[model samples]
Target: MSTKRYCYSCDLKNDSKLIAEYKAYHAAGNAWPEITKSIKDAGIVDMQIYLTGNRMFMIMEVDETFDPVKKAELDAINPKVQEWENLMWNYQQELPWAKDGEKWIPLEKVFQL
Candidate 1:
């Protein structure tokens, strides 16, 4: 099945120690299974996050049935997802130009092949 792709970016706190810890948490056999399952259940076919310095970029591939707003609503009601997000927030910071409550800001596609 063909999937839709979404890209987003966010910033991490400038603290080196915290950034290291955050990276460790996302390493193999470290990320919480519940969070991964939640994403899959939300129709996300695949997801990947890349980090450089204090910046983060994420790519998500989802099925045609995926609805970001609905997925967010579902996540909000899931305890494990909420816990994971809260913990992640400790190591993350809003972008300089982000509005209130925004974390990962969507990146517009300027070019596509």
Candidate 2:
């Protein structure tokens, strides 16, 4: 079975306090179990999020059958997932060029060796 990787990015509210709070929530032993389970249940094989200043880069490795659209639809109906996303939105913001409702915009592949 082959896996596919996707890269996405978003911005965090640029306040240092808020950024620190966000990082604290993501620190070892601090991650929410429900949120992590939801991710895996959506057919994600693995996921990592990196932060520099207020910018966030997320890399998701998903199973061959993963459907982001379907996953989103499911999330919409899951109260726990919706709560998690709403809590996260407190520290996140759309990229400058993103459409109104967009977050974690997919990045273009510009280089490969």
Candidate 3:
């Protein structure tokens, strides 16, 4: 089956201590089950995040059912997700081009092989 791929970028507070903590939080088996469940429920077939210094890049592959707007709406009502986001904000910073309160900014693909 085909999948839709999306990329996003965000930054963490430019501090080594906070960045280490953020990485540890996302380590294997470290994330809350409910948060993973919510992600799967949103039609995200796979997701991976990479980091360099304070910047983060996420690669997400989703099924045909995925809708970003719908995902946001679902996340809004889920207290667990909200909790996770609020906690993450302690380490994350909005990219300068991001809209206010936006964490992940969508990355535009400019070149492909």
Candidate 4:
């Protein structure tokens, strides 16, 4: 299995609202279930989410054959997923380096074990 880490930052001031939005979006929209289903359908082996301070992280172990671009396209096409993203955007602010509609920017790995 191969693993990847996704990192994103939230505004300190908007953290509470962002967290609330995340919870509400997942709970009301059944987003977590859908996400899990999609991941499993796409042959992901394992996944985990974590947060620290204003930083959010997701670790995923996906099948070697998984196509990221296709998965991204599928995400965009899911109405409930899109709705969840829209809801979360209300409390989300772009990072200093992000373009419009981008809530989280990827952090470059400068060092790794």
lDDT of each: 0.95, 0.92, 0.96, 0.63
Which lDDT tens digits does candidate 2 get at residues 5-66? Answer: 99999999999999999999888868889888888988899988999989999999999778
Worst 10 contiguous positions by lDDT, candidate 3: 96-105
Off by over 4 Å in 2: none
State the RMSD for candidate 4: 3.5
> Model 3, 1-113: lDDT tens per residue?
77999999999999999999999999999999999999999999999999998999999999999999999999999999999999999999999988899999999999999
- Writing each residue's lDDT as its tens digit, candidate 4 over 23-96 gives 55545445567666777777667655566654555566677766767877887999866776676666556666
Q: Give the winner by TM-score.
A: 3
Off by over 4 Å in 4: 1-31
Candidates 1 and 4: which is better by TM-score? 1
What TM-score would each prediction reach against the true structure? 0.96, 0.95, 0.98, 0.67
Q: Quick one: ranking by lDDT, best first?
A: 3, 1, 2, 4
Error of 1 at 18 (Å): 0.7
**Pairs in steric clash, model 2:** none
